[model samples]
Target: MFDRLRLMSDYEAPTPVWAPASVGAFVLSPTHLDHLGLDETLRTRLLRWQQYFDDHHPADLCGWDSPGSSQRYASEGEQLREELERALPGLRVELDLWPVPADD
Candidate 1:
């Protein structure tokens, strides 16, 4: 699905896990907008992710501080959200940043 999206749109597939953080940093930078020629909708989605991160404190899936983990998770989550929106237009969706455990 990800590869297909990359082939169809301006979106680029994310790098491998072991790839350098600098690569991810570059992708998150505003310069990518000009380089990739992203549409306003995609740019808006990216900005929304930035706002979400700014408004919420980082938390782990287990609701504990795992240092850098939360930021990484949020970045990946935002990427997935953007990809989904691109793949499925007009699909209303809501995301809970602080989700409760299934046993709760």
Candidate 2:
């Protein structure tokens, strides 16, 4: 169940928890999920995340900007962040860039 963790660069303080960045893969802790900036209470969101990930998986995002520019990736990342924050307390995973269900 905990297989799709995206390993990110070493965090100075922020515990890396399946970041969308193209770094590495790592598992997430209850505390780490809370740090993702969810609106629900940390405790509630943690449980929600655990159950949510059980069936669904987050997908990386890559948006397109202008005719051909690097802005798309940046844009996509921002959107993903917003979705992650807004989709708290629910397993909807609004921030998945390339959302692919774990069962899939």
Candidate 3:
């Protein structure tokens, strides 16, 4: 799912947005379905995550035009952290950015 999001970010050509039809499809298989029941809480969290990706991230990424982009990223990162805490308890999400040397 993260890879798909990155690919969408890298894409230059205009294209239709893609979102997963079902979180279950991305996070579980038929064999695992029994173990992980489809519940309201999980559904709500997945919908929120999907909506954030579809709306918030794209708007920020497209409108980014300043030195404070990192701040915006950090803000979004914090939101994701909070959401993950409530949704997946004990799960950790980290964001890392590496600067390329000026010589590059």
Among all candidates shown, the one with the greatest TM-score: 1
Each model's lDDT: 0.39, 0.38, 0.35
Candidate 3, 1-104: lDDT as tens digits:
32221111211212112223433213333233223342455434434434444443355465434435434444544564455445444433332222211222
Candidate 1 per-residue lDDT over residues 34-102, each given as its tens digit: 344556666566555444343333333234244354555455555755565554465422333342233
Worst 10 residues of 2 by lDDT: 7-16
Candidate 1, 45: how far from true, in Å?
0.9
Off by over 4 Å in 1: 1-27, 58-104
Q: Per-prediction TM-score, please? A: 0.36, 0.28, 0.31
lDDT by residue for model 2 (1-104), tens: 22224422122213223633334334455566665554555435334433333323222222222222223333444444455545543333323323222322
In candidate 3, which residue ranges exceed 4 Å CA deviation? Answer: 1-64, 97-104
